[model samples]
Target: MEKFKTLGGSEGSTFFFSVERQKKWERLDGPIGAFVRVMPWRHFGRKNLGYLFAILHGADFFFDFDDDNYIKVDESTGKPVEILPSTTVLDNVMVAMSGPTAFNHHPMMKPSIPAPSWARGFPWEYIKDEATEGEPAFSQSIPFVSKLNSIGVIHEGATNVLVPKHAYSPYNAQASIHTQPALWATLLPTTVPGRVSDIWRSYFAQCIFADSNLRLVFSPPKIEQIRNDHDILADFAAENDLYTKSGKLIDFLSSWDSEHLHFPQRVEQLWIDLYERSYIELDDVVALQKWLEALITMGYKFPELKPRFRNVALMGQFNFADFPNSMTQIMMWSQKMRERFQTTIAAAPLNKTQLAYLETHRIDAIPARDLKLRKRDHLGFYNPLSNLMRTLLRFENSSTIEAVLYAHDDALLNLTELSEGKYPFPTDKIANRIKGELSNAAFVDLRTMPDRAKARTLSHRVFPNGTISDIDKTIFVNTSSELKKQIPSLHAKYKQWGHYYCAPGQQQMAMDPEFAMYLDPDGSAWFPFHTQSDFLIVPTKYAKPFTEAATMHLKHFIWIECAFGKIVDILQQQLQAPTRLVKLCTGFGDRRGRWDVINNHDCQSESVAVFHPFKIRGRFDEFWAHADEINFPAYSSRGKN
Candidate 1:
């Protein structure tokens, strides 16, 4: 490429360096830009007068072991130097200096750009000769700059020579310094072949001259037939692969695909080829914008056609809206409505039935009856609004995206309305009853409230013992150890199957929109009289009465507590042990509890299971004392849960 002026300064002025002479008189040209040099101190000994010699003359830019032949001395003088030939030394020096400040430096690494703004028109200058020996092999016909500043090339009597920042490596400066002329000669084309070379040179010239933020774009080849217009350009770029800055320009132009072949696969292939060749990896948003722009520029036809190209190019950010998916759009719209209603309904005083009516009709309706007229109530399946909301919260906190929520506004609004209201719905009454009963327990109340305003009330409801709902799976420390330690083993052994019927604590149950786990403290049939036990009594008006009593009675219990992954895996491995599985029922109907009965007799006295409920608390050490008491190994849910 030509040596073109990018900004208004010396050509490649952004990169330049200086070197200073040292006490040893062993000098070499240093590199420009950020680089480090490893040198020995003893080379600049005081008596050799080498230090004094450095004071007068500047360094020879080429100071590798190949040329100087300076070996380490033993007479209390200097350190050993590795010997190398001049050719090796010559190959490494990038910029060199003989005497004075006259230094030779290589050409700047430039980026390939389509239209550079630095020089007025075709700003690149090329060299005629390709060789590097004897005199400067080539020179840019254009004058790059009037004067360039040189720093640190000649030292002021220091023990060690110091090259200026941004100078080439000390060993390679000599060779690099002499290459600028050759690059310039190659850039200035002379023959038909040179004319083709000129095209690439011009392209690079433009790139180097453009402002920092701007990038060039090139036309892609047709999918069916690749063009042979710039074979020479490819050869030049391929040979000079080390110029990273210029590689950027070479890639942008090559990514475009021609319109000749109308196949989708063909178009994709063309785009991929360009992407692979380009050095720059664009961000998703930037890529999307670029692809969009390219489509528009190409004048894409057919509604079905444009999106296919856009999606193929975008890779990640192609939205469903771009593809005209109505169902997905509708779902998104409904979810948004659900969220809006859920948030606003907290402050609105409306019953579930009333809210449901308003959501479905776009307006609420209330029926009236006269004294003479009597009508039967509407028989219908209750809408599981609260349950759905709880699930939504869990899903939102876990994996559900905001976009999906926003889209499902309508459905969400209807569900939220069905959940929040003044009139007593079956779910609302059932939830209240469960809370009232659990309040008699000694457990602390821990409710999963939608907001902080209801926490105290919810806590008061699950009195005596805390009501831990499925929603508290993460927050509540309801492990088996805590369960056995807090309440008696008799109660823990037969976990209230009915508790799952109403929402545990105040959180909505997910198992069946209508049921949850709420623990009852004063659960025994015998308890004090004349106490405030009337309100603390179980209210089953909302659910069907269980006519049949529990047939499975607990004789002995064992509890195992462990970390999620380890203990769970061990339990699975031991599943085949000879034991009848005991079906567990929570107050709610989640049905996840099933005990492994290692041994049991048919209503016999001596029948004892290897595993049964055992309390765990304080620290893990406390459980070891009871280890001998256990018939077999036991893990506790106290810590693991």
Candidate 2:
């Protein structure tokens, strides 16, 4: 440890001892701490760990050496020397890895030895002379060539090197240096005895690496293993499963189409496929899931684990006194160093253009008044338009109207009102009303009307110009049915018009042929529109057309919905256009005028809204509730619609 510390001098090297005093270990603020928190220490003992730790610590490569192993020394000089393969041998192995082929021959094999020898997990079927020796089988090299040093290349030969495409079994965990490409190679199936875990993991990793067109090199042994105090029988028992099923497992993994899946997903699917093929039990699947989840939670972004280490050159030397003895003090010093370095970086002056760009794109600087205006415009247009349409289409008079409203009763009334309305609008009353009055109605819920309308509003925001012409225009129709029919036609007529249509009750808009059709006509695209109200249209230039924006918005909405409003506001500011709220309908209950009443009602019922989803009773009751109080900020009575 002292030698390593000296050699790594101020290079940000960290060591974790397998001591009981884990709490005493400081330096938990960065990625290293995050990794230690999620490590499966209970399952794999400290002796067989650190692959994940290396990744978290941003190591370019990690060297694994067993305690039982020692570096070989020259008798004359008493100096250590790595036992590397000859150039000829490495060249032969290289030929094999260059093609789609698997080699069962061990690098330790000797031609002169008249006895048969095999690596621990080498398949018995390929143990014969022809399979083990002679001309090396070949396959096409990976189409994508990495810079010589960029990829995880294995160096073991004295003068020659080989990158084997297919990794044979018995790639021992000890005396190996794993680079970033093979970082996803995790020791899974913790229930399996420790003896075979590394072997199986290697096979699984090899299969994955091959899918990514990566090669695993088998080099000459660098260290000699000193025999440890272990019973041969016990070791054999632990390795019994590998002897029986290693080949079968390899074949099973090879069959998977990993080209289409991400590394993590591929790992998951591999375990599932294994279970489906009756190779592993359900418990194995569960264990695999836990391992994969731990990897994800530990912040392992596989296949693209880019090195993000900041190299800080040392100026002054550090003595024992400089390193704090107390863990808390050490942590504080480290944190202060980090903050100081950040401050230094932040203090660097930006050029005028960069400063201007930052100012233009700054979202926090957006005035509260502008945000309120935007919200008001959104609400004013959509609320009345949707309400008028519902009323005119006779949707409110439908037999199923009461039933629909009852289903979304929480959205209509607060908890107190819900409790009271139950007696008057019972199940029978709602059902009868639905069957009689709403039988032929569109059956659109008033609660979701805002979101539905917002979908269209978002479409307009993405493509400001009327679809048929570049000029902005607004046309109002008399009835709800006419508005619905004409909206799609109007969008179709305008070359630049795009429609943001969401299916009734959906949280967001759909990406379908119709959406594409609307986008293709005007080269307009969809942007993510989170609100249900479809009234306000901002004539602004967007970074992308409606189609691209809609696709991006859809993707973003899946991850988080709150960012939608922020993104829209950013676009509004960028376009530098007046955001107009065009009124399409009138005579619906004055939503703008009732802002105070709605705001007061919302504030009082905030708690009920939070707990309503948990207390929902009916099948669609949860969907019917307008939990916007929880989803959005309180409606301010100060904003004018």
Best by lDDT: 2
Candidate 2 lDDT by residue in tens digits, 1-641: 23222222334455654443333222344333433444345654333235544554556565666778887887888898744323222333323311112345444335345546556676666566343332232322321223222234353322123333333445656666666656666444554677776666667666666544344665556678897899999998978877788777766654444323456777777777767876556666665565555566556656631110112110110111112222222122222122111110111012344334323322001111223322333322222222222222332233322211211111222322221222222222111111122222111222234544433433322232322211122433332234446465332322321222222101232233333433423443333323322111111123133224334333322221222232343343344322211111111244432223334432443232212112112212122123222222232212222
Each candidate structure's TM-score, on Cα atoms with residue i matched to residue i, is 0.15, 0.38
lDDT (Cα, 0-100) at 443 in candidate 1: 22
Task: Choose the strongest candidate by TM-score.
Answer: 2
Number of clashes found in candidate 1: 112
lDDT of 1 at 15: 23
Backbone Cα, N, C clashes tallied per candidate = 112, 35
Q: What are the runs in model 1 whose C-alpha is more than 4 Å off?
A: 1-641
**Candidate 2: where are CA atoms >4 Å away?**
1-14, 21-49, 74-93, 97-102, 107-113, 132-134, 137-167, 258-260, 276-301, 304-641
In Å, residue 581's CA in model 1 sits off its true spot by 40
